[model samples]
Target: MQDVRVIPPYPEANEDGIREGKSKSSKFSFNFNLKPKEVKAHLDKYVIKQDDAKKTLAIAICDHYNHVAECIKREREQGDSKSDSDEEYTKQNVLLIGPTGVGKTYLIKTLAKLIGVPFVKADATKFSETGYVGGNVEDIIRDLVTEAEGNVDVAKYGMVFIDEIDKIASAANLIGKDVSGRGVQTGLL
Candidate 1:
């Protein structure tokens, strides 16, 4: 396994968590202590403008990782046999809407890098509901696995960012079936 440099939980810490010339390795361990403001500040260095989008994404990302950390701690304390019924955690999913060239991709990609998590980016136009000509929805999971170096555990906590999601909107004027648009959307759900 590649050694992942863990970042300190403070906003003023460096990328590699080096403080006073000390370094720590956090391999296969989730040490998420990032606040929403810290995340937004990190994005501000790379992505220009889009303050609202950055803030929204920062909150969602922090919520998701914080929940994951809590669940991991809980599982460690209790046995793994405790099923999902024991606790309920609503997934923090966000839908970002904006015009083209608004730094959407850069924002997400940068955030994923800062958190040391796998990220899979796919264009909606290349996918279809059926597994005939276009890519399947399951491809996203497969790509995540690849991004995590074939580690399923890491992929589970990964983020899948789909671009051009609006392209999948089903048009009422279309006859017969709308496999690419409506079908893809349904398959995602």
Candidate 2:
């Protein structure tokens, strides 16, 4: 197993936006040292075919975790002071589209396990716009927290796989508003 360096809790800003002492809550961060090739190599062992998808996912995973490590490093160095450099950081979001039976879920699950992070999978069709009516998008985050054993900080780095996203697409020919489709999309955003 690869060694993972776990970051301990640091002083965080309070409700008044002031960092006075060590916060009770821990923000989970880690050292991501694996290269893209290393990740792809591991995937190749379990997943067959879909070289393009594997390569893309490997690169994306490496980039994302590296960026997270950098951010954690910056936070540690800066202490309580906020940095303007954060604004320059671009967020990376990946949307994987493929036919059924593809190893999309398996690939992601493997990567998450390899990196020792939380992973959650949800069906888009089950979620509705309103929380009272159906599954709320925020439930995904909550599920991540649960996977992290109630550690919100660790959950922050968790991966959520929302399957059947295409099912939520609004049909053009619909007479009225597609609550489950468009509403779910908006909620996800």
Candidate 3:
């Protein structure tokens, strides 16, 4: 391995500046393996005046790929897991936080399409807290599993977007109904 110091030439001790140099400890990076032109194509679909978020995520995806590629190369040299090498894929998930109609949902759907993954959308509000008194919270996962039934390939490597999640803010006394909001987040996790 080459010994090229990764530390800054002139260290600036600011809060924003990275104190320590990059290390191999953080090998866990998520990547979808999208090409440069394909990335540009996806970004182009969105409207103008909002290139910052798009560019940041795009670069982040590329950086993640680079990091994982480096690890893969080292693993090949050391003869590591064969399955990972054969199936070059990474489960990279992202969350969008913004107001409605700001294209947050559109971004997830567009990204899924760009990456050729099965995109699934769900409304968290429509789900009731009273699942017949005995029903559990795992129905969310069951619903997702059902959604991706026929498309196994894409389902294995796809996206699920939950909208209107702010509906059940308080499950303890939801509109005078004894529902559980915490249960939903727990089920989601």
Candidate 1 vs candidate 2, TM-score winner: 2
| lDDT (tens digit, per residue) of candidate 1 on 1-189 | 223343422223344432111122223455577788888888877888899999999998888787767676677888563456447767778888888887778788787787766788999999987756889999999999888767665667677899998889888688886778888988888
Q: Give me candidate 3's TM-score against the actual structure.
A: 0.53
TM-score of 1: 0.78
Candidate 1 lDDT trough over 10 residues, lowest sum: 17-26
Using lDDT as the yardstick, the better of models 2 and 3 is 2
In model 1, where do residues sit more than 4 Å from their true spots? Answer: 1-27, 80-88, 171-175
Task: Tell me how far the alpha carbon of residue 109 in candidate 2 is from the true structure, in angstroms, after superposition.
Answer: 0.5
Model 2 earns a TM-score of 0.79
Name the lDDT of candidate 3. Answer: 0.51
lDDT of 1 at 105: 82
RMSD of 1: 6.7
lDDT of 3 by residue, 7-95 (tens): 22112231322121122232222224455445545666664545665765566555554455555556667776345544665534555
Q: After superposition, how far is residue 57 of candidate 3 from its true place, in Å?
A: 3.6
Residue pairs with clashing backbones, model 1 = none
Model 2, residue 176: C-alpha shift (Å): 2.2
- Model 1: lDDT of residue 180: 86
